[model samples]
Target: MISAQNIIKTYGNKTKKTQILNNISLTIADRSFTVILGASGSGKSTLLNILSGLERPDSGSIRYADTDITFLSDSQLTEFRKEKIGFVFQQYYLLPNMTAEQNIRMGADLAGNPDYRETIRAVGLENERKKYPDELSGGEQQRVSIARALAKKPDFLFLDEPTGALDEKTGRQILAYIADIHQRCGVTMILVTHNQNIAEMADTVIRMNSGRIETEQKNQTKKTAYEIAW
Candidate 1:
């Protein structure tokens, strides 16, 4: 569902010209789970931001299904982003004032999508419905953030180190929950992480370096060891 070709991104003034991404190319299938693996400053987050339509490349093209988003207008891109993509960042960007359930409900409310009560249940947040962000644990807060993203019911889900802020055990729990959702919801997911073990659970693993795709691995996807012990 995602296709990117010969992408080049640069920052700083022309006189300085620090090249951040170098001729990156990639293709991802419909409903396929892909894990993007890279070390720090390897352009994983930049690629994700571009793919999610938050930013555009200077050259090359990005095609998500029928549209080449690189060429879309600002208004069009905003509409597409609201309707077709959901993001889970390293930091749980939940609003502190809103209750957990209310925070998620707001995403759907903004999109005019279906009510997300079921999605809240899917994220295991039904029990912590009325709690505010500060009232929840780190793991619980992250679960609420995930629920908020899924509540939009976007066509694609982009996760940028979704477990980066949590402890190892909590991270594992979150990753398992994410893997379970990938299998059960059939939500096309692209997970960006530095952990090789987490990449093993994906249908496709994309390794990138210096803003370009280094290599990719396709696995039998149907066989996964992650059981929903959460």
Candidate 2:
């Protein structure tokens, strides 16, 4: 479980501080699909960064199970993230010159996963392993990025607008791939997006407004990617 309490975050200099997260307290269940929903500047992304140990809160604590990561050193945080976390974002972030297989290998190598080919197949990119990023379409590149992240076998998968750059049809396809991976791996998947439609696929939904959590609810019957409206 990931627990956060009284979390507060601010930006800017001391003379012009702007609060981004206000006294947020929440717990993310283990091996569950969670969606953090909010508009732009609602602090959804900031909260995801803090919870994933990418950023530290100005006040309060963020605990990944029993360890309080808030006090960890930069090196410690890097090591922790490398070992336990996987990320998929709006940007594909694949190397321009590297082949899809090489890009996926970069992540798999971190965790010594020799059978990383399975991840390429899982994302339906087995046939395009030799293709470079420039040779693939946006959706296919995103698939390679997702495959790379999963190849590390991370315990927590953080996705920030995974389909923000894709068309509706491609977005649905990516979401379906993510849903399938989540079900098969049972990793704790935390996704942050402004799209309310995406929340229906989550086991838990957290709504945020103006830097604070407005509501948090458990879905009685979560919908699949195909069932979600575009």
TM-score of each: 0.93, 0.96
Model 1: runs farther than 4 Å from truth? 221-230
lDDT of 2 by residue, 157-225 (tens): 999899989999899999999998889899999999999999999999999999999999999998877
Best by TM-score: 2
lDDT of each: 0.86, 0.93
Cα TM-score of candidate 1? 0.93
- 173: Cα error in model 2, Å: 0.9
Q: Which digits, one per residue and each the tens of the lDDT, describe model 1 over residues 73-167? A: 99999999999898998888899899998999998887886778988888888889899999998999889888888889877999999988998
Number of the top candidate by lDDT? Answer: 2
Backbone clash pairs for candidate 2 read none
How much does candidate 2 score in TM-score?
Answer: 0.96
